[model samples]
Target: MSIENDLTEFISRDVVPEGGVTETELLISSGKVDSLGLLQILGFIEQQYGVTLLTSGSPKDFESVQTLASAIRKARGESA
Candidate 1:
């Protein structure tokens, strides 16, 4: 699976688990994810992509699957 798809699935299963989410769905602002959910997302990122994410940033910037995929690509030094 691609990064976007992977993230969508992980977020849906591990993050939301209720109504679930689409790739372009609202993430942070949807109010479904709390601080603990954010931590789970970060952990999934590190474990799946071998990249450490998050430090001091706005959660609103998380956005959705497309946004997160771009961040992961950028972190890996891969072109969009």
Candidate 2:
């Protein structure tokens, strides 16, 4: 599975178990994801991608599956 797919599945099971996330869905702003959930996501990105992402603590970084994937790619020195 791709980064977006992985995040979507993980968020669905662990974060927002009630309503699954879409690639373009609002996560943090929508209140579907909280601080703890954000930490879980960051940890997942670090462990799964082998990249300890240094972020600006921007909600945009954790906005959606698409944005998160882009952030992860950027952290890995890949084009976002």
Candidate 3:
């Protein structure tokens, strides 16, 4: 599956807890993800892509599925 699709599924299955809507463009910082939730996402990324993703600047930097997919692509050395 594409990174975007994989991330969307991960968010739907994991980040949002038992059952919640997961919109790809939804802002993660808008209470959809808390601190613990961010850790879950990072952990998922690490396991799925076998790469560490550093959230260097801001939480907003990783606020959407599209952004997460971009990070995955960059880690895999694919053009972002």
TM-score of each: 0.88, 0.87, 0.78
Model 2, span 32-76: residue lDDT tens: 999899889888888899766555435578778998899888877
The digit string of per-residue lDDT tens for model 1 on 1-80 reads 79999998998898899988898887878887788998899899889988776863345448887888877887788985
User: Candidate 3 overall Cα lDDT vs. reference?
Assistant: 0.72
lDDT of 3 by residue, 2-80 (tens): 8777877887787775565354556455677777877887888888888677644245448788877776777678998
RMSD of 1: 1.7
Local error of candidate 1 at residue 20 (angstroms): 0.6
- Using lDDT as the measure, which candidate wins? 2
User: lDDT at 48 for candidate 1?
Assistant: 90
Better of 1 and 3 by lDDT: 1
Query: For every candidate structure, what is the RMSD over all alpha carbons to the true structure, in angstroms?
Result: 1.7, 1.6, 2.4
Clashes of each: 0, 0, 0
Q: Give the lowest summed-lDDT range of ten residues in model 3.
A: 20-29
